[model samples]
Target chain A: MSDIYTNNYVIVAIFLILGVLLPVATVSFVGPLLRPKKPTREKQTTYESGNIPVGDSWVRFNVKYYIFALMFVIFDVETLFLYPWAVAYKELGLFALVEMVIFISLLIIGLIYAWRKKVLEWN
Target chain B: MNTLLQQAPSWGTTLWFIIAAVLLLAVVLGFVTYAIYFERKVIGWMQLRIGPNRVGPLGLLQTVADVAKLLLKEDVRPQHADKALFTLAPILAYAPAFAVLAVMPFSESIQFADLGIGLLYYIALSGITVLGVITAGWASNNKYSLIGGLRSAAQMISYEVPLVMSVVGIVLLTGSMNLEDIVKAQQDVWNIVPQFIGFAVFIIAAQAELNRTPFDLPEAESELVGGYHVEYSGFRFAMFMLAEYVYMFGMGALITILFLGGWLPIHPSLDFIPGIVWFILKFSLYVFLQFWIRATMPRLRVDQLMSFAWKVLLPVALFNILLTAVVVSYQNGMF
Candidate 1:
């Protein structure tokens, strides 16, 4: 593994070239055989069954989803720290338990904010 | 297979590793292409439709043909897009996914860069892939693309926490972040049995991390219309797809390493296949499972997705980590 990491630029170049080329090679070799000629405007349109697209692809979404996502961000950060501490639970014992309580309490506070805003509900 | 290179001081060892990694990377890349073919085939089967039967035998070469079309197609760059970032974004999207191939323990003899903190590096590198999405979105000056990219960055970053936290349970049980070492730690029993909650949370979070279905709101086709890569054309789009599939395999590798016991044969007392074979089998199974989930489930609202990861998965992961640490210590007589 150490030896693998120690390889220099020429090695790197060869690897990079292989990475770039193999996909290209696969395409070149196999493509012509499967070639389907593209003709008219119909071929270019995005496929949504047979009907033409209803509107321009772009559409506005509800801002409430954004609010819910924002609330999730708050709780998720709280959870990440809990993982490391959980691993050390045996050695840390009571201290870990105490700390976790404090951490979760903060998350609960955020949950309260979401509850008050009714962000958790589906519209 | 673990034989040390006796003949090498510097040049020879370097030459050997370089040759081997190049060979492996080629194989892995081919596997990535085939994986795309496999995904289409399997998903088609699940959806009860024929996929790419005409492209090659079993439509095996369909991805190859599509690659050619992409290459031959005109490169479409939006006029207002930032030239530098637009060009650079694909690399950002792609490279980290490949770099993660380093820590995945395909075999005891395999693995390119087995750093002690392999999991940490994998997560860190993956997180940066989000930046590429944002760069592509913001640089494009296209509003839909901008919203898509921003949505992705926000969604991915939000879920990243639970993703890492879920893995913390396995890391706790094994007492090492080096994937190979962690697998070896699970020599007695696969961590999945002991850490089921962590396993479940990790799998869900990983699905979200890959921006996969049910959790794929970032590329939500209904409203966003091709989403973050909306403006990219030609090979740039191919790069994004390739990166995504590679990362899917990478996630499979991580799940296998931490939870499925890496290369350790599932059957005790009888070992026919090498550890590498087990690793590949397990990894491929998980990858297929991802496709299955995609086929079966409906996309969740972005809000619901985050709450599921944070409220549901996060707590479960923490609980598993705590439980594993205690159980392992007591059993080992550490207490």
Candidate 2:
């Protein structure tokens, strides 16, 4: 059993390395060999539908995206709590069930608060 | 195969593992090539167009030719773009897309790593692709690309919650996170019947995760003008495209394992058909459904997309987990 566990992770690591190499190699080595490399001032400029660009594009974005990110962080952590409960549900039985129900209800209450506040309304 | 894994560590086994990884990469590359062809043909037929017949026989070589052309195009990096990050983003995105496939069990005999936490491994690794997308968008230094990237980040991160929640019902029922074990638990009945709501939520969230039609606000060509990949061209662009299709394959296989019973025959009496064939059939059904939806549906408004993920799908998925838990406990007479 321990052997298979070690073998499984070894294979996973090898594949991860290969996945990174495959695309990087193709784009850097093989791509340059075959593709054209001519560069003009106009061609190199940041594309804005054939017009001269304005100020830097890395300007501040809407704060609503940050709010959504916060919501995601909260809910994502909440979701992780269910996994251990799920795995041991049979052994833990109704007690675990009631506990999860309480936990989920609290999160739901939070979701509803966000809903009422129009945090979810996506203006 | 279990015996193979149990063998003592040696150079031969290491070589074998390397060979297997390469072969799997080849198979995935082939699958991605034809998946693109298949998507075009399916959507073309739906739209009453013949679609790409000029490239090869029945357009069989269309994607192949397209890939070659992309490979041979100018690899342009826009001035003022973050050059290092721009180059690195494709690798970051494409790597996770491929790595997630390591955990997908195609059939009983055809699996790579049979990790006990296979489902969690898949979900965790799949999340990394979002970083690549956002990085590509930020590194592009283009307004449209930045917005597209942020939009994708928001959409993927939001939809991921419901996606995970939907899968939790199955985990509760199977009592195991190993995908193979989950499929084995479905021998008597597929989870789709009892967990139909999860299935629906999974399908929706999975589509949004893939950033396909209706949820493709990030790359809504009509709006953001190619979205996050707008500044990408040549081989770099192809890597992003490949990642999307590869992720589709991974997601399709997952839906098969979770709801359609993986490679299990539709009925016990149908056991004469091989499991791999059943796996392919179910997987094709999913891929076809993606194309069908793409052809018929209009893209959702960005606001509607966000609301649907948070407001509609997340709650329904939560309800599914609750219902499954209650029913399973009752069945065990623990209530």
Q: Write the per-residue lDDT of candidate 1 for residues B1-335, one digit (tens) a residue.
A: 12333322366565665677666777767888888888888999998998888887878889889887887665566555677887778777777777666556688877555566677777877887888887887776666787788778777876787777777767666666677788888888998888888788778888888999888988898898878888777677888888888788778888888889889998766467787888888888998898898889999886687567556765666566556655766776655
Query: What 10-residue stretch in candidate 1 chain B is worst by lDDT?
Result: B1-10
lDDT (0 to 1) per candidate: 0.71, 0.91
Positional deviation of B310 in candidate 2, in angstroms? Answer: 1.0
The estimated TM-scores of all candidates read 0.80, 0.98
Q: Candidate 1 i-RMS (Å)?
A: 6.6
What's each prediction's clash count? 0, 0
Name the runs in model 1 displaced over 4 angstroms. A1-123, B1-11, B329-335
lDDT of 2 by residue, B249-317 (tens): 899999999999999999999989999999999999999999999999998888888999999999999
* Deviation from native of the Cα of residue B313 in model 1, angstroms: 2.1
CA RMSD for every model? 5.6, 1.0
